[model samples]
Target: MNLSIDVTNNEGVSNVVLTGEVDAFTAPKLKDTLLPLTKEKGQVVEVDFQDVNYMDSTGLGVFISALKSTKEHASTMRLVHMQDRVYRLFKITGLTEIINIESTVQGGM
Candidate 1:
């Protein structure tokens, strides 16, 4: 799986834009990239999936693990711009309620 990550730091928030497939082979990579960003004090991490084309359970696991790690470090993590299929996956897995998923970057409101 091919994965690309672009991280933007803004006002204590880390916007991570993810593109490409996130599967077992690539989930760890995503985790590694997100873990450190979420460890910073007062850091709010947002994983943007607007460009993602595919994902699997491992991808969901990556998000869950990131959320757990972020909470441990007193940081926040959220999902943004998920495609319809990705959103359905979250809904089917009941992760939509467990994680912070926004339709847009503006708090999904």
Candidate 2:
């Protein structure tokens, strides 16, 4: 299925809710939605992956680029509520070591 992204801003944080598969086809859409947020200094961009069932290497690359962009802007990017399969992808790729991931909503909120 195609990917869907929902974005909401709360205070200074941007909450991005992602659903469906994130592959090469949909990864660009994710980047377009997120890359701009990373340009806003002091902005906190939170990606909630609770509904995302699949993500490929392309999607992972998008997140890595966003992480770099956010850091350059002195902002932060958080990955939240990742499914077990998706989380394992990050773990295996060693992205978990570089990216900020919050398993609990409390930490994200």
Candidate 3:
């Protein structure tokens, strides 16, 4: 499976829309697209996961890295509109405590 990323920035807000599977093979691409957006100060990165049905630990690693970058650079990162199964990974790993994740929409890709 492949991951597709679309990004847009407006008034310091970066919106990232993700589609397809986010596994080991596609995590690097997601990292590449999202990391840079979080490297700037005062940037707010909003990642929409509505169409992201599947995600592996590698994808979590990417988000972790991005989250770290956002913190180091004085930025913020958010994950929204996630599917229940995909959101479970973060919850199971206890990332929900440290990361900003919301909108667990019921359904799949």
Which residues of candidate 2, in runs, are more than 4 Å off? 104-109
**Strongest candidate by TM-score:** 3
TM-score (C-alpha, index-matched) for candidate 3:
0.94
Displacement of residue 12 (Cα, Å) in model 1 is 0.5
TM-score ranking, best first: 3, 2, 1
Tell me, by lDDT, which candidate is best: 3
Across 1-109, the per-residue lDDT of candidate 2 in tens digits comes to: 6999999998889999998999999999999999999899999999999999899999999999999998899999999998878888899999899999965444445
Ten-residue segment with the worst summed lDDT in candidate 1? 100-109
Which pairs of residues collide in candidate 3? Answer: none
Q: Per-candidate RMSD vs. true structure?
A: 3.5, 3.6, 2.2
Q: What lDDT score goes with residue 100 in model 3?
A: 95
* Candidate 2 weakest ten by summed lDDT: 100-109
TM-score of each: 0.88, 0.92, 0.94
Report the C-alpha lDDT of model 1 over 65-89, residue by residue, as the tens digit: 8888888899999898987777888
Backbone collision count in every prediction?
0, 0, 0
Candidate 3: list runs displaced more than 4 Å. Answer: 106-109
Tell me the spans in candidate 1 whose CA falls farther than 4 Å from its real position.
104-109
